[model samples]
Target chain A: MLDKTTRVNLLYDHYGALLTEKQRSFVELHYLEDLSLGEIAIQFGVSRQAVHDHLRRAVDQLEQYEAVLGLVSRHMRRRAVKRQLAEVIAGLPVDDDQQRRLLELVGELCEDGNGTGGGDGDV
Target chain B: MLDKTTRVNLLYDHYGALLTEKQRSFVELHYLEDLSLGEIAIQFGVSRQAVHDHLRRAVDQLEQYEAVLGLVSRHMRRRAVKRQLAEVIAGLPVDDDQQRRLLELVGELCEDGNGTGGGDGDV
Candidate 1:
């Protein structure tokens, strides 16, 4: 299993825009900016416990979004499949135009997969 | 653009379980069961307008979910990529064990992609 921070970061990447402004700020500050809970509390003019509670709730909401939508897990699996495909293409003995074309297609698949899935935006 | 029925069906497949019971029932009755709005409203002891309103909200919610998550778009693109890969694999000159294995992997990717993204479940 991924560590909590890593997992939350992954979830945040997929569902951050869905969060409210305060929740999004807390996540970005605490996780991406590496702010301590106390520091975030000071920045937001709230109690440390309040900040902690808000962060916990925001993280739970992110996990819930992942549970329902599952974009993160699907993206990861697609990436693994693409990697495997590249490996197989590399091992092919034929060095003809078709082989090169296959390689190019694999390259495009990797890039296209990332382009489609890496961010939270309408496509 | 997909026809409205086709688009709603696709979105429903991806996000049906997230909907309320009433919304799910109306959509299933009208779209999946081919029941008209009046038929569904009569069965539920409500006005046809009420049924229409519920279905419209439900479909809008499903589209909202898709707009944020983009799972339907990703699934479609992935299917297209898999088909292209299969075509290239079929045209390859090599007729060896490796070719067979590559074909199997492509098949597995197709199956695995569907298994992961076709329904709503926590994987």
Candidate 2:
């Protein structure tokens, strides 16, 4: 259950910006802010049920995008590959500085994953 | 327009499986099969307008998923990175076999992008 929440959080982290303003707000309040349905309803001037409905729809959209694109999963895999490459490089006769540079490149790849996801207008 | 079609084709390649059956069929017929609107409508036992509606909705859905997930764009960037790496590695003082191996690894990364997109159930 803990892992599920974390995974959902990561998905939201990657896709939240693409959601509608209302959906984005609802998701952030419920998930990140840890607000109860009634509390979120009060903040948004809606009923608790409406708050729930919005949050559900938003989460559904996020999940659908993930199902098709698997961006989050792809990033995770790239990180795994990088880690493996690091492990393999460790056994090589390369100097410490070269190994460190390769590892740093791997780290940058992970960070760049999120940034480029916004696509053409962004770059 | 040519570029747009290519871009949409790439999006469909990654996401066609996630679309509904009707949507997928319509997309395949109109885009890939290059059938006339009336031809597809007759084959599907529907009006041309209905076929248009399904295709429009499917394309909209695909575009939405891409906007959020950017899997196609990410793959494109990774390919670009691989190309750049190939160029860089070409100038390195490494043996020919080692350089070839690194370039081959980069090529595999591009190919692997589409495979893991199916995720856990796939692996």
Winner by DockQ: 1
Model 1 residue B103 CA deviation in Å: 4.3
**TM-scores, each model vs. reference:** 0.80, 0.68
Candidate 2 chain B: 10-residue stretch with minimal lDDT: B114-123
| Native contacts present in each candidate (fraction) | 0.21, 0.13
Residue pairs whose backbone atoms clash in candidate 1? none
Residue-level lDDT of model 1, residues A20-72, one tens digit each, is 67887889899988999999999989999999999998888777666766657
Q: What C-alpha lDDT do the candidate models reach, one value each?
A: 0.72, 0.65
> What's the CA error at residue B31 for candidate 1, in Å?
1.6
Instruction: For candidate 1, give the DockQ.
Output: 0.34
Q: TM-score of the candidate numbered 1?
A: 0.80
Model 1: how far residue A47 lies from native, Å: 2.3
lDDT of 2 by residue, A17-114 (tens): 56777777777777877888999999889999999888888788768667755767766766666656566556655566765664554444444344
Instruction: List ranges where model 1 is wrong by over 4 Å.
Output: A96-123, B96-100, B107-123
